[model samples]
Every structure is written in C-alpha cells, then in structure tokens.
Target: MKFLKILEKRKSIREYKSKKLSDSHFDLIDSLSNNLPNAVKNQGLEVNIFKDGSIISEKLDGIIGYHGIMIKAPHYLLIFGDENEVAYKMTGYLGEWLVLKLTKEDIGTCWIDVGANDRLIKEKLNLVSHKSVLGIIALGYPKSDARVSSIYAENDDKLISENRKGYPNTDIEYKDNIVSRRKPIEDIVFLSKWGNKITAEELDTRNYDEVFYYMRLAPSWTNRQPWKFILDGTKIILYIESSEQENNNYELIESGIAMLYFEVAMHGQGIPGYWNLEKLEDEKKYGAPDNYYYIGYYTF
Candidate 1:
C-alpha cells in the first residue's frame, strides 16, 4: 500500500501556490515521464513541460469563451499524441502515471480536458505534422484553503454508485469542494464473464486487495468510470463499456489510465508485470456481450 497514502491525498487542486518549482522537481518529473509505461512503449507519446504561462494564457483564452478555468500554476505539462486512438490512450496512460508520481512527491495536479487551444499548443511545441495535443496537466502546490469535498468519507464504509452527469461545458467554473465519486465494486468488476457481479469475498486475489482498491480510485473524465474488468487468474481483461454516443476514443484513454493505476499499485508492492494489447481479436472471439467492447489484457 505504498501509494495508499498518496491515493488518499491526491485531489485535483484547481487553486495553486504561485511559487516556482525547483530544478529537482522538474528533474524528477522528467525522469518519471521518460521511464513510465505508455500505450506504445518505445515510440510512445511526447510530454513537454512549460514553466511559463504567458503563451498558455493567450492560447487558452477562447476555449470555452469564459476563460474561467485557467489555473495559475507555476508549471504545466502538455501531452502530445500521434493523432490516432492509440496515441490518445497513451496520453492518458502516461499522463496519469506522471500525475501519480507528482502526487507521491507531495505536488498537486489537475487534469485539464477542455478549455485548451490545442492547435496553438501543438505549434508552440513544434510538433511534427502527425502529432497533436491530447491534453494538459496543471502542476503546483495546493493553496492553504484548498480542501477536497470527497465523495467517500473518512469512516464511511458504504460502497458508492457511479451516477454522474456527462462532461461539462467549457464555461464551467472551478469548484473548491470537488466531489470524487466512485462506482461500487459490483458495478465494475466481473467474475469470469461480462456483467457477472462479484463481491469482495469472490475476488480471489488474496494478496491484491489494495491494488484493486487503488484501481477503483483511478480518475476518469466526468467521473464516468466507463471501464470494466474481468479477472481470470493473473490476467485482467479490459473492456470499454459501450457508449451509444459516438466513438470510444476518450473511453479508451480512461481505460488506459485505469490500467496504469493498477500496474502502479502492483509495483508499489514489489510485483512485476506488463501490458498486452495484442489480444483484441482473441478477446472478440469470446463473444463479450454487446454492452462491453473488448480492449486488451494485462498479464503478470
């Protein structure tokens, strides 16, 4: 449970202290960014760190027409992808890992999904033609008055539901008391097949309690938690819960975030493993219900 303390304290802090980050902080962050796992490992996504905000402010002005979501942090990490589904997922995978690493260092971060001038950011970073900005991560120290209005209470033992509204519009303002809602375990975890609910007693992971718990706490867009897992021995099969909207691009990114969280939790306990996305065709042969689309698998 090395990350347990960090997972408990890692809140998306919108308000930040204006002090600059030291060179050591940037060096540690850069090291983590260089070493962490990504969707495409060797040739994965690229991350750029900006210690200044002048250009960022100009580029982010018209995103939602209000410019109210601007977070005045000393540093911002811009994540670039290859303008493809895998790259987008890699953004989430590597980005979330970097965020956790920062959290472990006692730094605060906020995942900015909207209100970004992605085009301007790409140009500022001088990215190649095929690459684009996936998203940005705001980094700084939390303000003295910053407090998280978490959905889970200190002593509340009840499993919560994942009934949240869709993504917010660009005009959305930052709130101090942000709620961190999570879906009940039965709603996301399956036994052997899709939709097969399992209780904590049936998880079968005798030593993986905290790892699975941290996986449930992974953040997602609009707090949708739009991913599910099917535990089969030491392998965890992933699925992007079907959405009738358009495509599952963003959902795939969220799934990648969840997978990285699981892997990080395992590594915190000295366990070793790697990801395997080559099972897409084989997973389809399993005939998972239409509600669940097979993504890939992570094996130990």
Candidate 2:
C-alpha cells in the first residue's frame, strides 16, 4: 500500500499479540524518536523506549481495564518535553507522527493519557526536573481484529450546502462513507487574505490537492475542524478558532492533533516547514485573536 494509504488505514490499536519488536523495528523507532524535526533545531525533547518485561508490567499496574493490554505490548515509548512555549504543541505533533510511522512498520499503537503519572515514570527513567512527561504510547503487534471506534459520515449534499453558506468557488471530494468529508476549497483557501475565497483554478498545481486531501482526513473532536490554512507562495499559516464555551482545553488539544496531521502530511510530501510564535494580524480579521498562540508556519 502507498504511504498515505497506510496513514488512512491506521487506527488506535489497543490489543496486542505476544510477538516482540525486532531489532530493526527498535532501531527505526529509536532513529525516528531521536531525529524528530523540531521548531527549534536540536531542541531537548526526549523519548525513552521500555521493552524489559518486568518494567513494562510494573508501569501498567493499577490502570484498570488496561492491566494486561497495556503491558502485554512488547514495547512502549515515553515522550517528554521541557516546559516552554510550543513544547506541548510540538510534542503533540511529533507524537502523532511517531504513531503514524509505527503503523507503516506494521506495529499497532494506542495513546495512553489517563492513569499514567509522569512523576513515577520519570523516576524510573532517572529524568531530572525542568522537563515534563508528555504521555506514554503502547506499541506491539495486534491481537487480530482489535476494537476501533466507528466514524460517522456526513451527508455530502448537506455538507456542500453548509460550505456554500460559509464558503464559495471551492471544490471538495467526499469519500463514499460516513467516515470522511471535507469542506470545499473555497471554505478554506483564501485569496491573499481572509474572507477572499480562492478558486480552484487559482491554486498551485503541485501538491495542493494532496495536502488538502490529507488534512481533510485529519481527526478532530466532534469533527469541528476549526482550522484554517492560508497559503502565500511558499508560506502557510495556521489560524485556530476559539471555542464558544469556557475551559475548552480539550478543543485546544484537538487542534494540536490537527496541527500534527498537517505537519506529517507536509513532511510525507517532501515539504519543509517550521513552527513559529509570530502571529499574523490578518488572522484577527478572520475571527481569531491578535494575541492567540501561533501554531506554526510552513515554508517551501
């Protein structure tokens, strides 16, 4: 299967077989973990791989419903980042990339967040302070036909109508199932500025469709897809929409996941980009804030 297809087919697999990750697999994980692309070159993000059966078992203790499934895996990857601006966002992006890469290696992975304490895990790894544990990822061969959450498909006509109201002159392709839908290009791609819709004919022919295709497939909470991409020649800016409700950290996390998807899709296509802290003033005109966090920038 093609690389992008592997990404699309990947699911968060929880169950695992008894088989262990080979030396080569370990090497691949190590290389990818150690060599992850960072916004600041050679940043201090750290990843520790645990494979010893005893240590893995101990880590899984007291996590109800995940007792065996969590530790049964042959290996686990612990990702940590130093406390700083964009650290959590960067970790989220790179973490999701590792998950996708693991899928290509025919390994199953599930993201573990709840019930796992960074303090305890840090002591095990001898990691000092000034760094915070991000989360643990469980990886191994799957125990055939693992349970996966079902995706609901949106109605094409209805979605198109919604896009017509929100955007214009853009095209979108929908996969023939409840699992995939995309906003028309008009709804997203703007013409040199916000609210100025760009037509399909105005877009660059190289990789534009592919980038949008992969991004449209990215997972989001409640499928809100509150991300907007602005393309100016070699530069791409991401503008995030704030939630109407208060205390919406979950939405921010979901946006982080979307940012990861965009970065990976760009990398897989040989596009080089970097995350930045600078905010675009035009973004505020499009419903974003002047002082909101700038997720990243993509450069050709």
Candidate 3:
C-alpha cells in the first residue's frame, strides 16, 4: 500500500524489536533527508539518526529521572530547530515528513517529546543557544507481539521545568487497547465558520475526504487534539482552540504537522496545494471565537 493507505494503518507502536535496520533501509532514509519539506524554505533544520539509541536514551533517562515512558529502539531521529516562530513550525513539518518516510519503509515510529528536554541530549546534538531539539522519533521494527497497554500524554510544561522530578499522570494503566482514539471529523471541523458543524459525508461529497481524513489523525500532546478546521469553499483555514492557561509552543508544532498531513493526503489523491501562514485580515468576521486564533490556510 502507498503512504496514504499507511496513514490509517499506522499506529503508535511502543514495543520494538532490538535488531538493526538493513543498509538498504538506511539508504532510502538518507535519500529522503534532503527532500523534506520546510515550512520556511531553505531554513537549516538538522536531524540526527542514531543507529544505537543507548547513548541518548541513557542521558534522557538520567536527566528526566524516569525510565518508563521513553521507548527503546535500534535508531532514533531528532529534529533540531532554533527557537522562533518559523523554526517551530518547520520542526513539525520536517519531523512528520521523516515519520511518513519511515512508515513507507515499513519502519515503526512513535513521537517522543519528553526525550527532547534533556540538556545532555541537546548538547550531544550540538545545539547551541536558542537552538534545541524540537522533537524525537523512536525508529525500529515493531515487535510481533507489540501492544500498548495504555496511552498517556506528557505534560509539555513540566518536561523542561527545572523543578520537575518526574512526569505526572503518565503512569495510569488502562485496558489492553492498542489503537489511540481520534475525535470524529464533525467534532473538530466546521463549515465556513466556527461552531457550524457538518458531517464527514458532507465533506466526502465535496472531494475533501482525503484532506480532512488525514488531518483529523494528526497526533497532538495528550491527544488534546487542540485544533479546529474551517472549510470555506476551496480554502481550508487552521485554528487552535483558545486557552487561558500558559501557552506552550508544542501546539503550534502539532498544527504544522497536521497541515503537512493534509497537504500530503491531497497530493496522494491528485490534488495540489500549499499552506499560507499569513494571518487573515478579517479572521474575526468568520465567527471564530476570541479563543480560536488563526494558524494558517491551505490554498489549492
């Protein structure tokens, strides 16, 4: 199956086999490294492919003071970005592209955010001031009997806190379900304006099934899925639902990843488009609440 089909087939596999990947697999991965799409064109985003995850894994475990959440794999990918608006978005854009490339190679991956907070890990990647590890991906073949006994979201704020001793609310064990649940399209999507709902059937008739289908599946912190879409004719605007608490940059990164998925799925279905991140002039005219700020628009 193509990468588009693999979108739905892909699940976050926590258990991975210890065997090393073949040379041909790494060759394919290396070929795609230069071809990754950058939200900011020509921006220097670097990725480190660790064939043996031991060095970085040990550092992350030592710094975070926890060993349970970090997944062990034969290889890992770290996307380093300079702290800025464009770099944050590009981090997600390039990182997810690599994730999809690995998926196409039949390699399993799980996004590991907590691992990015380690000072030693960042130093090992040669990240200087203002540049840091944006995200990490655990890469390897999934074990034949791999199953996630439970799923939990790490508190992004606490991950980097100087006072943090361990991650909270991450050890709760649930049932043996392996697949993560996604919110239905109707709950996360709107027609022309916010709070104006429409069913997936409505979108399928308009030839938007592929775009919205994949966008809805984009991963987010804690599965908060803190995003909403506004479909106005041929334009699709992205928004993050408003929050009162201290804001984190991870949401913007996740939105960028979702935009990439939407674009790739469109291309997979023979549609062409690019994202426009410029804030809309009359964004409030669309009935979006004060809490829903514009992220960008997908123009076909």
Candidate 4:
C-alpha cells in the first residue's frame, strides 16, 4: 500500500461516536483483516472485527487500556496470537499494519494496550486456548473534534522529544491534531558501527534518510520511541534500548511496530526487504554496548 500520505495522516483517535460500523464497511475491513501477511510465519496472527463494542468495553472495563481507562469506540480490531516473544513482535507488526492500512479507508484507530490479566481477558473475549489477546484497536469513524491519543495524553511529551524540523517533511505548517514529537534520527541512527552518528549527507546518499524519517511516525508505547537502527556493512540491524527492551509484552510489541515502519518505508520507496528476526550477536559480532539490545536485521 502507498504509505507516505497515510503515515502523515495517521494518529490515534481516542473519541468516537457510539455508532457501529455499517455492514458494507465491516465486510471490507473483515476482508482486509483476514488477508494480511503475518510477521511470524509459524504462528500467524488472527484478527477479528468485533462488531459489538459494548461487549468488550463493559466486560473488559479496567482490564484493557493504559491504567484501566478504556477508549470506548463502536467496534474493536482484536488480535489473537501465541504467547511468545516472537508472537508479541507479530502482534505489534500486524496491529500497526492494520492501523496504517485502515487510515486509507478513513477509519481511525488507537492501540489500546491490553494490560496484565490475560487470563481474565481471554475468558471474557472467548478466545481460543492456544492464542492470547495480544492487543486491541479501538476503531470507528473518528469524531471530528476528538483525535488525540487519550491513553497517552497523560504522558510528558518532553521525554525523548525532538524538534519537527529534523524530519524530511520540513513543512512545519502541516501539523496534525497531535504535533509529532518523534525522536530525531541523529539520536537513533548509527553509522557502520555503534556510537558513530550517521551524517545527513551519508544518509541521503544511500536514500535511507527518508526511511528513518517516516519510520519515526510509527505509534509506540507511551510515546516512548525506544527503537534504534545500526548500519552494519550491508545489514541494517534494529535494536531497542535495553533499559526499556523487555517488560511484559509492551516493548516487544513496540519492537514489532517499529519493524512495520521500517519495512513500510523501505517498500514505499520501491526497495524490497524484510526483517530477519533471528538473533544477531550484539556483543561478540559488533561489540555493541550493553544498552543496545539487538532484535533483528534487514538486508537491503
């Protein structure tokens, strides 16, 4: 799918009119949901467009969302997958992929973090025994005046903040309902080695500067964009801050969301590539710092 415009247009919508989706629109989303390619081949993510919103918001009240504050919409895009680090990655990728895709359909989405209590969540949702409820996407036609990520509104935007000028879209006038506060590429991208900042000219020369620019648009947990990219010879390796790498499934899902942005940006530019999730030697292979936890690599 063409992504730049959607990436520019994408942001979480917290408020929605309680009107449920029309049958035609529901059918379209159902088709799209079933056909998506799973990030993990062995365990494909299963998605459902739960038509009745109240069944969940009422049942899962205080069980989902950040801090038990649920963002109630008319419907939800529910994701179910195996309980594993790989599946968590798949959860993020599939969820964000659908979120971005749904943007083109004019449907707004928000990643409502499915909190702890997976057992209760599983029982309430009537999910299969094998797969766990990875996350939920509150979906609907967005209310005209309500567009902010309600769950993340309480967060201090100053944390890991960056000026908008650092991105490729220097047209600062095109601000969305929420001003983008993505981490600068200078702080995230390294040269052929760790701790070496990649110059803009070098990034531009390789046509990769735009990839990083758009990748930052991916929605992350609490707006903590804890993803980093390393230019290792022919390999472009992905890593997250070890400090925030693993804690339950939040960061793991964030890693998968980051993976989607990188892949989407690359493919959006007519470049063909995929993220290899196999472990890369961070310490022995490249002597990366303990702070950088290598997740995977993409050979462009």
Candidate 5:
C-alpha cells in the first residue's frame, strides 16, 4: 500500500514549475540511477539519465513527442539500449520504476512519447550512442495550478477502480476532477489460460484482486493498456497485444511498465517475485495466439 498513495496521486505533469529540482532531489536521482535494480544489468540495458534537460527540451522540441510537441521540464531521462524487443520492455520497467520512486518524493514525472524515427531523433538530440532511444521521461515539480491535488487532481478512490480496497481510507476530494480511466480487472486478467477471463470473486479467491486492480493504473502509450496476465496455477504469464502494422516498439515498453506495476503491487502484498522474461521459447509451447506477444511470467 506504500505505493498506492503515490499511485493515486501520480499523474503526468506536462506543465511544470520553472524552478529546477532541488540539489537533494538531484542527488537522490543520481543515487537511484547508479544503483538500479539487478534486473536492469542482467538485461544488458544501459540507463543514461542526462541532467539539464533544457538543452534536450530545446533541441528536440519538434522532433520527439506526439504531433512534434515536447514537454518542457527541468530534468529528463532517456534510456538507451540495443534495438531488441526486451530492450524496449526493460526500458519501460526501468523508466516507470524511477517515476514511481520520484513520485514517492513528490517529484512529478511524465513519459513523453517518442516517435519511431530513432536515427533522426538521435541525430536531432546530438547523441553518439549506437543504441536506440527506448523512451523519454520529463521530470520536475509540477506547477501549483497543474499539481494533482490542486486543479488537475482526480478523485483518489476512482483511481483504483470503484471503491477498491487498496486505498480504503483515502478521501481526497478535489475540484476540477481529471477522471482516471482504467480497464477492469476481468478485462486484462485471464484464468488458467490465455483469454480465459476471470470474475471478481475469482480474483479474490486467487488473491489477485489488489495486484490487478492497482496494476491497471500503470501509465501506457496513449492510454492503450496493451498487456494482459494469465494466471497459470503457481505462475502468471504476461502477454502484450501487437498491432498488425510495423513500429510496435511502444507496445513492448508498455509490457515492461505493466510488469513493473504487477511486481510492485505483488510486493506490496508480501508476495516477492521477479519476472522471468527468458521464457520466450515457451510461447508456442504455452498455446498463445500469434497476435498476442509473450513478454514474460512471474512465479511465486
């Protein structure tokens, strides 16, 4: 439940206060970046968080982000790694973990959508790294008018689905509500197999109601929640829906974000587990469809 409070209050802050992040906050970020979770190292993904985002904000303004619109923030972090599927997923995992950690410190964070023009983007940003830019995240103290608890806040209870138990005592009532929309638990969680939907009672009986409830709150590309979970006995298989068209890199990143959210939610409930993304060869063996890409699984 430690992150539930943050998850409730966590919203993408596009418009930020002009003031830069404090020195202590900067140090905290440096520490976290250097001491990333072991999974990041194991995946061979390198995280390069460049401070002084003004230069990036200025240079790649019209090149990156949707509709060539970039968010101006005091700080920004970019993930660079080999051009691979799991690279994109782990990028999502690493970026979202930092976002949540920053959220815990009341530092606002927003993942800016990067276009598929990777080479052009690297050229515009004056990057030397041969790795692809998995994602970009803007960080800053949100403007008072733009703060979640102020003008743009959503009702906290509504964040965890209608009357969810994750944040039971939260009663943050704010005007100018920005409704937080999430797909229902049954919509994303499959029972025993892929596409085998489960009911609310089923989730409760399997002790997964809270995990899927809060996991649905994870941020995704254009709010497209592309990931799903299959509860296979003692294990949970993850799948991300792939578009028919090319450039489905963002979908893999969304898979990573969902993975992180599920892990955090499970960890909160005293369930410790890590995703075994090495099960790529088991996709056909598991009887998954072609459209749904197998990402990984968690065995507790």
Candidate 6:
C-alpha cells in the first residue's frame, strides 16, 4: 500500500474480532519482531507474542482501564527491554519500529505503558532480572467504524495544520477532518544547526516535500512531537529533546514511534536510508545542550 494511505487508514483499534489471526499475519509479525533490537548493541530485547486471548486476559487483569476487552484480540505483543544491558532510548526506538511495521501490515495497535501496576505485567510475563516490560501493543484487524477519542483527533489535526502549511497542495492533502499532519518544515526541520530553518530550495533532494509530508503525520506522545530532523545532503540526523524530566523514557519511546513511521514511509516510497548513532557537534553551536540524547541517524 502507498505510505500515505497506510497512515490515513491506520487508527488505534481497541475493539477486535474474536477470530484468530492468519498464520501469514503471525509470520509477518514474528519476522519483524525477531529483527527488532531490545538494545542497540547485543542487548537482547525479548518480544513475547501471546497468541492466546485467555493468557493475555489472565496476565492483564487489574491493569486499570485495560481490561481483557483490549487484549481480546488474536494476540498481544509484549516488549521487554533489559535495564542493565539496554538503554531506555534504544528500547523505545526499537519497540516503536515493531509497532509501525505492524501498522504497514494493516494490523491495528495501541501502545500500553507500564503504569502503577506495571510490575504485575512484568511478573506475569516472567521477565528476568534487570528486564522491564516497556510497553504492550494490542494487535489485530481493526473493526470497521471503530470509535476514537474526539480529543485525540482534534489535537492531531491542529498539530498537522501548524506543521505542514507551506508545502504545495497542503490544504488538499490535509483537510480539517484528517487525523494527522506534519509540522511545517520551518517548525521542525533544521539546517546544520538547531533553530535555523532549512528552506525547500536549500534541500537538494527532489523528494524532500514528500518525505516531510509523511513525517508530519507520524504519531507522538500527547502530540508533543518532540523530534527534530536535520538534513545534511543524503543524511538525516534524528535528535530527541533531552529534558522531558518526568517520563523521559516514555517520551523517547514516543519519539521512536514517530521515527519508525518516518523511516517506513521513506523506505516504502523507495527512499533508501540506514539508521546510525552519531552526535552532531554543531548541536552545541546551535544552542542545543551537550546533554542532549543522540538517538540515531537515517542516511540515504
């Protein structure tokens, strides 16, 4: 499917059919999950797939607001990151990648955080010492006419309009009712340094507009949209805001989810790029702190 169409059709599905997922569907998920990293370098992040709804229900009991209803789908993707071996940022990034891959396969997902009783889930999953249940994603086919929170839709629309107005045909692509939008290039995309806006003419690529268009629609936590992309010729450097203070891991995870969306869209459209981890020295020159977290890069 076209990347934009996937983004347009993708929505959080809490309600699902009781039918089992196809073997092909599970195979696709298994392949992606196997490739996903629990940590950047040799940190074994184990992703346990619970195909049985009964097991999911037994494990998810007492999770506030997340009854068996959400997990009643065909399966649950449990993402666990080893605290001693894996950085929280890596966990978030890789976990987000898995979710986006599922999205591309037409599977529905909603990321569940380890809240007050996260320990219960961790114990139920039999995670080893120094490992944590980073998040839970309920996966299955989305029911037609699934209802979404109006507030979520409204926030996403407002952010899209604010970020993606300058591109040609922006209005037609981002009508008021659409659920997502890209922040304008000026607002998010930077030059060699932060705070300096990279103009369309400055971008050497012919596909710059198309790339950013899909990026604006990438999802974020509470629509914080805390990702900054700096383009240097064939390279795109991803930087996450370092000072979320509380829920820093959660914020990084959210940014990772957005990055996966951007990368998938890029690859699906035949834009070749590879992700790397390199700190830009110019970040300090641009008034960004030295303490900023260097997530990774996507170089074409």
Per-model TM against the reference:
0.77, 0.69, 0.80, 0.86, 0.84, 0.73
lDDT scores of the candidates, listed in order: 0.64, 0.60, 0.69, 0.74, 0.74, 0.60
Taking the tens digit of each residue's C-alpha lDDT, what string does model 5 give over 1-300? 387556555677666877888899989988987888876876666666667888887888768764455667888888888888878889888988888889888888778767587787789778888688878888889877553322112233334353322222333332243234667778888877776789999888767888887787777655567777888777899888887657777788788888888988898877888888886555565566888888889988
Full candidate order by TM-score, most accurate first: 4, 5, 3, 1, 6, 2
lDDT of 6: 0.60
- Residue-wise C-alpha lDDT for candidate 3, range 1-300, written one tens digit per residue: 687776665555556888888999888777777566645557677777888777666656545323344566778887766766667777777877777777777788777754346466666545464557766778889888565321123444555453433234333222233123667778888898888998778888877776777776666666667788888877888887655555356666777787787887888878888888877888886787777668888888
Sequence-dependent TM-score of model 2: 0.69
What's each prediction's clash count? Answer: 0, 3, 0, 0, 0, 5
Q: Provide the clash count, candidate 1.
A: 0
Question: lDDT at 133 for candidate 5?
Answer: 81
* Candidate 2 residue 234 C-alpha distance from true site, Å: 4.1
- Candidate 2 stretches with Cα past 4 Å from truth are 1-5, 38-41, 52-72, 114-117, 120-129, 149-188, 192-197, 204-207, 221-224, 232-234, 241-257, 264-273, 281-286, 289-293
Off by over 4 Å in 3: 38-41, 62-68, 114-120, 124-130, 148-180, 199-201, 242-247
- Model 5 TM-score is 0.84
RMSD in order of candidates: 7.1, 9.6, 4.9, 6.5, 7.9, 7.9
Winning candidate number (TM-score): 4
Model 6 clash pairs? Answer: 160-181, 163-183, 163-184, 181-216, 182-216
lDDT of 4 by residue, 206-259 (tens): 888888888887776666678888887678888886554335587778888889
Give candidate 4's error at residue 161 in angstroms.
26
Output the lDDT of residue 169, model 4.
Answer: 19
